[model samples]
Target chain A: MNKHLTVALDAMGGDEAPAIVVHGAEIARERFPEARFLFFGRESEIKPLLDASPALAQVSTLIHTDDVVSSEDKPARALRRGRKSSMALAIEAVKAGDADVAVSAGNTGALMALAKFILRTLPSIDRPALASLLPTYKGECVMLDLGANVECDASNLVEFSVMGAAFARTVLGLQRPKLSLLNIGVEELKGNEEVKEAAEILRNSDLPLEFAGFIEGDMIGAGSADVVVTDGFTGNVALKTAEGTARLIGSLVRDAFQSSTRAKLGYLMARRGLDGLRSHLDPNNHNGAVMLGLNGLVVKSHGGASISGFATAIGVAIDMARHNLIHLITQDLGGVFMGQSVEDEAPLSNPDKEASSR
Target chain B: MNKHLTVALDAMGGDEAPAIVVHGAEIARERFPEARFLFFGRESEIKPLLDASPALAQVSTLIHTDDVVSSEDKPARALRRGRKSSMALAIEAVKAGDADVAVSAGNTGALMALAKFILRTLPSIDRPALASLLPTYKGECVMLDLGANVECDASNLVEFSVMGAAFARTVLGLQRPKLSLLNIGVEELKGNEEVKEAAEILRNSDLPLEFAGFIEGDMIGAGSADVVVTDGFTGNVALKTAEGTARLIGSLVRDAFQSSTRAKLGYLMARRGLDGLRSHLDPNNHNGAVMLGLNGLVVKSHGGASISGFATAIGVAIDMARHNLIHLITQDLGGVFMGQSVEDEAPLSNPDKEASSR
Candidate 1:
């Protein structure tokens, strides 16, 4: 394991560009003194910010980029035209082994496309999955395929299970995570063909993980499993729905506290305790969403993330780089494909061919 | 429209069967003085419960049945063997015109299977959908296909949109509900083939309802649209995820209030305001999940519903019955199928044919 980690930052990305990137790297630097940064952005904007933070400037190498990928740019467009963009350059650094990992808070689609095109997928991985940590009753659980592939086949799901389990092991520090497929119902007969097929495959596999048959959406927050796996479409909807519900309840709580004079007084008295609860549910606390199954690590920070949130994303990349996430995923995938024929694995390697054949 | 409504109750269903049914009927009778009830269950158990409530007994007729559907029974097994069961009998009453609506708190899959088989789908409808109200920032919104159809085609999504819109109109009292398809993203080219196809069809159609394009899951709680439509699998997951998130936050709030003496004192002062918030977000307040697009109204109450929650389910059925929910759906579907040919519509009417063809 390399004690000195080098992280490439897309300095021009995110809602609050250079300022957030500069400040966030400084915070991350304080925590990880051995870690160095390569910032890719316009020299004019990043230089001023770096000048303000002498400590961050000392350990960071500023790489100038004339262009940046906008949030509105389609993945295809970004891939075709954003070669010299900060987001693309940061990913390129990882691909070229100049940096151990890349951290970005830019357009998700653009980042995903650029990362896939540059870093490429590992030999055993069919598709890369977007995995993130969600706050649950029993601390936090990891869920994957947030929005990477809209439609996933049985092979894709099986591949995701391996990658997600590997991620939980690396990030959550679990030796053998309890993994489950997300279905409409926990029953054996429930859900679509793809989910059922994946479950059957997992049940028969000799993987070194506890395969907790199936779990419903409600059980996700209750921490029924350490790793929750699903197709991107359902996973994306479930994740967003959870976010919306939390926000709705949060607003309602605020409204309640302001409804009456007594309530206002009560809120003042309970402010400290409520603040603790607030931080626990805060998105910034769980900001990093990693793109797993790639040849190199790429951690995506929320576009609207706070300074600490971006730092958390950098922290995720550091952990994965130090822990050898790519190597772990490669070894896990080898176990998955041991019993399968080469013909069964051919279609999943190329998504374009798979789509055209379908 | 029926001025005098008759509701059939599956008295053998739910966690606290006869007691919740009888007490709930007593409460419903107060709200709708002209409403009558038909209780189907074991004579010995229900006779004693009905005997305790004279007012409810006067307006209710107990129909003894020996069989009941267990919660663990699969849908196929329940349909094959539960012919004379309480849940089947309740649906039969609706089919026989002995009841305007049937309310059950039984196994959801069993209830859906029996209701679909007995009542059948309306002519223009392919499948019946499970519709429910969810609390949102701007009051409440209706979401459909909660777990009815696992994999829906483009036409099925269009049907859900019409049924969901009709539901919002009849129950929520909206003149022309703002309807939207649930997708991974709000963009036109964002989701899978089915969603994009449905959106294209809707954009070109002449339906009376407001087609607000696509909405992501997070927008569901923001009340971005009055009627949110999706396939059964995704819809079910989203609804449950929202429920789970709300419960998670609620528990955290309780923990915050109990953390210290000052927090406990603050909770006492804010008790009244917090009570109002609790009721606003209470599952009991939004208990009923209606099986929409059926020939007759069938409301499914939560198995763990309190007396008030069961009454709320009855209230929903009463509203649907009185407003002629079937007729509204029929009229709405007429607008939807105005342009399509008969050959294009044949595949949807029979789910068996649709599945076999697939």
Candidate 2:
């Protein structure tokens, strides 16, 4: 680990800013003792919290910024007018080489725009993708392009595959991670033109990743692949849908336990076992969403994440910085593109004609 | 209820076709005593099963058709070459007015293709959408188009809203169902061109259904809206993702209860309450997916559904037929379009430009 590794924090972002940010940083400091912190927010609001944690205060530098990117602000507006906002300043810190990474829990659109504008994407990447780890039955898996690019073409999906595989290697520590394109069906002939075209290219190419064929949404939680790739729109919907379902089941279980005295007693006796299940499925255990393909590391925590969740996001940012995720992505791109532009690759000669028939 | 409502069954479809099909018919007979059955498959394979259920045999007419559409057959291939298959014959029965509705536990692509070709679409409908009821915290909600149309234009989505609203009215008996377009965010400026355009049209038009504006995927399971609409690819992924999450939770719950002897005793005491939860989340309770906007009612059951699951599918078909789902959709479409075609409606002058910026 770099002794002087620094992380910039958007302390004025998120639903419960400053407090969560300060407490989260303190928690993260214990895990990554060598890491330094740069807090950007209203000094008046953050100083008292920082003072409470003397150790964190000693290693942290607070930069005052009253300007904040509001939750309702449009991305364009945020990018144009939020130059002095905490979110923007934190990202700028990364660009200025003061901080190795930036972590925010602000509005997703605003965060993406600022990160892209400040950090810029790697030379080989057209658009950076939002990649996150989701809990599966067999531990966890990484899914990419989660609301980053709503409409992705063949080349864009191929780029996501490379970036996603690189992310898995850095975070999940899986070498030659098995990847699959998210589709409606597992059949080779299913899905739209873009997915079918992307699959054809990946199948023929000698990319360093294992291109497992198309996977259905139902198989995602079964850990069918290490990396699941899709256009932003579908990925976003799928991810949110999974979260919603988990909440629904949790609510139903609570209702069931309260239905009868016997069930209530059962819940008491089974509390320990259920607690393990709860922790395993908790969002705090997996909170970081990295914007892959960016030149500098940028992690987005959930807007409503607790202190622990925010700390987990910080840990993710530190891990990416330590592993050199950007370098890894560039290397993976070099292996496949091989001095040729993505557009220069041969187009699919015969895309699946029957895809749109139904 | 129609005293002579007849349903055509594709007896050769599904993983365990002949037995599940025959047993499912017996179960449906108990619910809808007025409904008759026309079984289309090989009489030799189906006779013994039908004979075992004497009551179902009394109401069912076995029609011999040796040919069957395989699950692997492409939709286009099935449309061209599967005219004599059991799936085709069953849909033909609906086209010939021999049955009020057609129910099939078969390959979705093949079933959709055969239904579209044989039964045809309504005059005002460009493409039929696949709609299904999903269990939610508040009863159930309807979602579409679950892989019927991979890519949909603004007009197609508008048409789906009308069709979905009608389906909700028929099945859920809501006078003015709350409808929402599934997108990544609930903001007015979020999502792609087609979704934004469709939302604008729905907002401005005097459609019978209550337009509840945009909804995120996480709100779907909370029953935030009565009808949820999206393009086929996204809708399909979201539905499967929810199912996958539910199954994951179920597996986790089982593992938790079996972790210790005390937990096992708790499970024994809580078995009744847990059973209620299991039945509530069971796929068997919601097995049918209807091809909305077709001239005739066509319901597709899960290919791997058990006897009870297939029975639930038949129950769904009967409800649609009884409530006249086709006529309701025609009425809803007529009210909105009036004499003007969907294309003639003014297009979105200023679609959200920031949609693709990120």
Candidate 3:
């Protein structure tokens, strides 16, 4: 089954690309030996790196592309002028059925734009959302719309809930994912109109999803829900805030350990356990942000991620393709519950229109 | 200087009220010997606790009241029926000039509602905001609107920036506080309309504030700016997420230390330094979420806060009242830069209306 899977790579993307990309593919190839790859970038730059990885070279095809999308390029500019760029071509591979999934660690805006433009959104999805795994006390949870579609309507939120549930089921291997809307408070009447309306829809809907009601930010780490759905703005802020807090705590821990001679000795004794803790909290262990709602799967690795991180992202793509996440989402969206007329749906662009009408 | 200050206490507020509030007052009294207090709540419950602390009792006057607002009480109900309640009476002390500031660890929604209705808002401010100090690597930063106004316009955010700057100057003791609007991206064109418009106003304004442009959530702990401003919804989520992350990391560290005999020994050796770190990051040490923009000073402590936390909140109230934060904000608002006509101001209620008007 893995032999049929083809992963497309945007080799010219990220801060340290082609080299890290090839090395990471080598690591992924070792773990997923049956998977094949199509590398999209300049042949001169990518060929040498692939040659260094004999095993990766054996299972990969180098698709030459001279044009590259700069990290500084705006999403609009990238879309209009980057038709031949490595990132665009890589996404095209997924659209053309040459690859089961496409992965990039390039400019997030450009990737989202190109992916949305070329692959298009799923029939039931108005816009694609960025979803990533967050390590929670109970295990892990998925949060969506990390930085896509900042202003979302109730219908858009409901769509995100559906997408998040599918993602949790596929990636987290959950029987039935409990989904919650991220809000200022867990109370029914709290938060803005969009969240309240979305909750109302979810609570009343006959969808297969387990509607877990509203959840506060503190509950994200407490593992209150399998999937947390939010507008891009809140999700982005929460995700980054969590990251910043983690980093601050980590530095504080190190500072404490180095404050005294006794603490230095303690550090030596606790080095092994500390290493375990570090690895557990490492972003590389949880790499791969899947852009859900697209017609085809497109996984994004962190631009500054290491070989291990990139390999983890590849693993996510492999799992997603194997599980047929898109198929499951389509099937779920096509169900009897989703056959309700568009009048019940709110346009994400004009959320206030719904508010006024309601 | 504190001789003129009198703090109003909602003696029945908080999870462990009466006992905790009384104890906290004693602690604050010891810290600020010149400060006096007017405690509002049932005299039967508070008299004994105050009697235990003779020093606090000498400086305190008990205002008997049988009514108490429960944590579950809605804001509207709290405002309408809580006139004789402890929380309301405590706020009334500030309004009636009986206290320099009022401190409560009650239901945040109710406190805000009652405070807004009784205290009223400053002429330059359309809505109130919640501000709190967050520990960062470079020391500390002030973030606002923690959860006061759910939805804000561009003008409200600009106002928040002004308020947050004043807060940093007063509490954090910064000479020229660097202020930034919290956004998903730091780019000029990124984020929702409110944030983008707010950025434009700040960039063009001649306010004394060092408008540092947009900052993402991760920068909050990096000390990218002294003041971080955002709408209440996003700010609340980010703040909670940061707190949740901190707790998760703390637990993980403890788990690591207890994993093996060596780590246990390490924990013992590093106890002193770790204690210092703990105190620095402790919520009690940094307690106080001040409701800004109100005519009177009001500090809201966490309902679950300990005596130390409540004492810290009282300290914040004292500092704000002493520094004349509201006076400073009023002066700042009356400056030449704020003379721009109301046509430039965006309406908070109907954000979409502004979208079309522009």
Candidate 4:
């Protein structure tokens, strides 16, 4: 999608870091050999993994960086101590205009914070949120602020709507992403004051999203709206709950398949159909979480993401680089809401209601 | 659960009222022959359903009433008109000490309005809310304020948590139910100002609940906590979404079973298992929405619920009477918190934003 180009990879991050990360990078590289890969992390840790397979050594470059940022480190501390940190260095590559886009499967908060701190946000952009694609019965549903900003206001929600639409258009490659506010209730008068106010603002805002009125929790998996935008709080709950339920359903289906000889026989007959369903709901196919509304692109992979997840995140980064997603969001939000250019938008305080997760 | 019961049934309330309502009364009558039933509405319409069956001999009385309340009536308007409505007549029967409890599968707003306006709220209660038992992997979870109140404060949430715990224990026969606040995120400071303040109040105040801390959306069906509490805004979302998803999953499974000859054989062999799962997740099993904190028991059934659902609502009402639930919640809240007993606690409003429903 990015026309085969280079991407800055964070090798010393995530649960299965360096190994799974390196393996995923290799898988991605083999598929698109023209795309150059810059691996910035501890060379000692990553080199062996790459050397174990000659194919990975071909398209990937191992940058010598000795520091590693633990997921437990606070975003501010990580960035401050991370000038030499692999994560910070990888992000710095994009900020310094070296790497086209920076990608990581590490701490999301740290990634968003460093991306905003280093590369900065576009005009009228207060915070940059990680918007990810959720696979549903009706294909993929785009949800933003998965864990980015928690205490988001009406204005911040409006910004998310704008940014989410742009991401859906560019990365998701949708014509006009249908947008809906994620509220506790579908009624206009319901929810905390923030949601009611956001509904009014989005109703009048110039964002090109097809303002599909409101979508409730039921409609989320039902596919009522193509792109559902909300503060990080509701978004994270919906995303995690849906993922958990999907996983639970998968487990139950597996149990059913093994419960009896007859079910096992049916499963054997419909192996292809069952496999199709499994692949459709696979987390690996929809892995990358983009930090939307920033001047430079940054994508966070699932920390516990598998190899397929890693490859998907890399492809997402490559795609964003080619499309210049930030430029598009900047231009759109700047012209419509703040009357400034994308590059000129000042950084507003991220209205993140930090969840219990690290 | 109540060995012998008398229930005032608003036969003219729901979409299939008079028919399904009468049918449910008959079914319930069949089980409990001594259970007194009052059919309040048009006598002409109900006499036929009763006369056309062998169950008519057990029909206690046909209390002819001319008024009918539509589902669209706002609570305030419904309260004014309910004076002459069939639903109001039913409540009056409870007030007159004729029936132990009043059950309606009609307008939710009307039922709540009449219950509060006629039966009034418990002294220690604020607003009455619809609390229901939802399906769970563990068993059943008691969740409250599904749609009663919209704009709630922290104090209200604390109260809901208390009321939810008490109802589950007294009626559902749960012992020391673990309580949780339904939040977008589980962090102490993750929710809006109301939730944030409520979390503080719950942390300090005395209530009968176990106070398990904040639980998220997807956690509802997962049986994360025994009792989940939120304002009606969020509770309604969780309830409706779960109901809708259950319906979706049920239909999908049914279709999957009928997809092919092998699938049909699998379905036949596992028919009991599939039926058990269906009944386990059946909305009819969870048919009534209780308006808790009221002076008198008020339970709302699904408008589209059939005979089974209505019968379940009646059973809930009977169970409430048997347990003396209103007294228990008040005593539980007061004994745990402050001021005399919980029965002495329902002041209707707290400055910290604690109202029962909204």
lDDT of each residue in B1-358, candidate 3, tens digit only: 4356899999999999998899998889888877899999999999988888888889999999999988777777776789999999999999999999999998888888888778887776777788999899989999998888788899889888888888887888887899999987777757788988999999998777799898988789888899999988898899888888877877888888999999999999999999998888887888889999888999989888899999999998888888889898877777723666643221233321111000
Clashes of each: 0, 0, 0, 15
Best by DockQ: 1
Error of 4 at A160 (Å): 2.8
Give lDDT tens digits, candidate 2, residues B35-111. Answer: 89999999999999988889999999999998998777777777778899999999999999999999988778778
Task: Tell me the fnat of candidate 2.
Answer: 0.67
Ranking by lDDT: 2, 1, 3, 4
* Native-referenced DockQ of model 3: 0.51
lDDT of 1 by residue, B48-141 (tens): 9889989989989999999999877777777789989999999999999999999998878788888888888887776778898989899999
Query: What are the chain A TM-scores of the candidates, in order?
Result: 0.92, 0.93, 0.93, 0.93
Q: Give lDDT tens digits, candidate 1, residues A312-349.
A: 88998898888988998888877767767623212233
Candidate 4: lDDT of A45? 84
Computed on alpha carbons, the lDDT of every model, listed in order, comes to 0.84, 0.86, 0.84, 0.74
For residue A190, model 2's alpha carbon misses the true position, in angstroms, by 0.7
Question: Considering every candidate listed, which one attains the maximal lDDT?
Answer: 2
Output the lDDT of residue A225, model 3.
92
Fraction of the reference Cα-Cα interface contacts (below 8 Å) that each candidate reproduces: 0.67, 0.67, 0.71, 0.22
Candidate 2 vs 4: which has more TM-score: 2
Q: What is the per-residue lDDT of model 2 for residues A1-358, given as tens digits with 9 covering 90 to 100?
A: 5577899999988889989999999999999998899999999999999999999999999999999998777777787799999999999999999999999988788887777777777776777788999999999999988887777898889999999998898888998899999998777777788998999999998887899999888889888899999998888889888888888888888999999999999998888999999888887878888998777999988888899999999999999898888888888877867876654322222111100000
C-alpha TM-scores of all predictions:
0.93, 0.94, 0.94, 0.84
lDDT of 4 by residue, A270-340 (tens): 55545566676677888888888777888888888899889988888887887888888877775577643
Interface RMSD of each: 5.4, 8.2, 7.5, 4.4
Which ranges of candidate 1 are over 4 A from the true structure?
A342-358, B342-358
